[model samples]
Target: MWRRFTTVVGRVIPGAGSRCRKRGWVTPVTVVILGLSFLWTGTLADSNTPRQSVLRVLAWPGYADDDWVQAFEKRFHAKVEVTIVDSDEALWAQMHSAVPPPFDVLAANTAEIARYAQAGMLSPLDLTKIPNRRWQQPFFQRLSDIRGLVNAGHAYAIPFTWSSMGLIYDRKQFAVAPSSMRVMWDPRYRGKVLDFNSAQHNFSFAALALGYPDPFHLTPGQMRDVARELVNLRRNLLTYYTLPEEATALFVQHHAALMFGNYGTQQVEQLRKAGVDVGYVMPDEGALAWLDCWAITRNASNLDLAHQWLDYMQEPEIGKQLTQREGLANTMMPVPGGASDAGPKLVWLQLVENIGQREALWQRIESGDRLRTFPQ
Candidate 1:
């Protein structure tokens, strides 16, 4: 039995030609529907029934599709149960819901991989089994060079897809591309800027715009300063958005002039498809990027099968399909005119000093917390 949990939500943002509604604090709600279970039946005697290996997969929406899972099941004669998660908080909760963890494998960013590795929830990979990794670009081949991926001399995850959180501007709003992240804070664009509704990325990028040397690790004073800066950003935002589609809708409907491209190129593609003339640029302070990878659980029921799943994702054809379908940059090949290729600079995501602290403060800020409430 293959079960998939999916989230379906109505178009929350108004249409492009709709009247601009008064800007206020908007919290998007996600409705999760239990999709019908797919049962594969075959002719067999009850006594001769064969046990099919079950591979439980936890991934982001676009990472795992029905066609891909169906192909894997057909090739290996296994049952794949996929679970989709929209946020890191939900992913962490699902992983910890069971003793051995509910899923056999998961797709997470480098920072989340480090967090899982520290908790001993992930198993080290045997690169020998994933031979297709050789087809990856030179930058991805050297795993050790990337932080949060290799710990204690063991590789915990394999690179899959990545993009930098750069700046997205409406071409009609700006004669030249915005060169700095500070553009989002410009008073001229007040109530016309869109920012991702993420605690970690918001704090990290705020630090970058403030000329902080290290974004992941911040001093107590630095944290307070970043929080205050975010308060200023809140005043300029039309509203915070959670998904790329939502951001696109808000951008078009509100006639937004600028946005922090949290989804990076993926958001850019979505906006373009929506008939918006948008240009993406990496700010001078550098963009915070995320590299999503596949990692096997520490207590995987089928170790070989989990490894095969990782290898399957690395196949050149599979990578191409993912890129074409999702507008994501796959590791197997170079992205044509991609931001990561010969860009300003990319600060690969790393484990932050204190995720708990960031989240608590972000909650307050996003809820319309006043500037005086923040630390000095």
Candidate 2:
């Protein structure tokens, strides 16, 4: 919910590396030889030769499409290599697989952006280069208002798309929309509920339902309590789903009455297209929302091109196309009946206190670990 490109070896300057290690500095004779090699190998090519810049993009499935990428390439006279990632774990693995990240730019949620920024994997953006950001809504334009985009007085990400994880209930089954997250736990919906198979969100939402002050940063006791709550939810769940398409199929097949809309409105739109009359709502405990943004890598090959790509995404028409095609809300415009619609509070995602702990415990809970084994 995310490219193949030939690796281009960077040209090494004669004394660039040696400058840091003076003891192994290149000799004058060696520098002269290297200079000639550059000329002989055509490293300094003719000025008239047309050169196309390559920009590798790592993004979610709907974020980078063939047609949209083609348009960006044509406009900038560059080549875009696209790679799609379906989950956060995979995205992190790919980003760290290489010494200098393989991609020039990537799209990631705010929490991931914070993690990458903290790890020094991302480059601070030059806002001046991205003129199109002015088109973004006020809520998005204020980088400080949104956590995880700025660090140490520098902004590292530009908002792209966002949505909330809410509840989706079968319209025919319920006369009115559910008002709280507790509805999923009601015995009436037991064996008829579908939940997304995600450790982080499951724990966060469970904390929310239990009325934790900060869902992202739970104490040791709170984590144990939340884990127990998830164990209870497991009993109510018809089954866990990894993808929206899979959830849609399970919902229709099992005649499921409720589902944790992990993909938010995107799932709603999909279910509707499949002829399912579903109603979505953010429970009284507030829904967890994600704001995905574009950020250039610290080792970006071409900063100008990367900035151009970010600016291009912020363009009104491109944003409109993204919303219309993917059913996601773009920062450039407000989408009616979108996650920001009236009545439901949205809790923007934040870097959690301990992701490893959440994943480990969630694995045990999801694998049928006994509730009695959990700490009281």
Strongest candidate by lDDT = 1
TM-score for each model: 0.89, 0.82
| Model 1 poorest ten-residue lDDT run | 28-37
After superposition, the stretches of candidate 1 with alpha carbons farther than 4 Å from their true spots are: 1-23, 30-48, 335-344
Computed on alpha carbons, the lDDT of every model, listed in order, comes to: 0.82, 0.79
Query: Model 2 Cα RMSD, Å?
Result: 13.7
lDDT tens digits by residue: candidate 1, 190-304: 8899888778889999999999999999999999999999999987888877667778888987789999987888888889999999999889999888889999999899999
- Backbone clash numbers for all candidates listed: 0, 10
| Tens digits of per-residue lDDT for model 2, 204-243 | 9989999997999999999989999988876677777655
Stretch of 10 with least lDDT, candidate 2? 30-39
User: What is the lDDT, from 0 to 100, of the residue 188 in candidate 1?
Assistant: 89
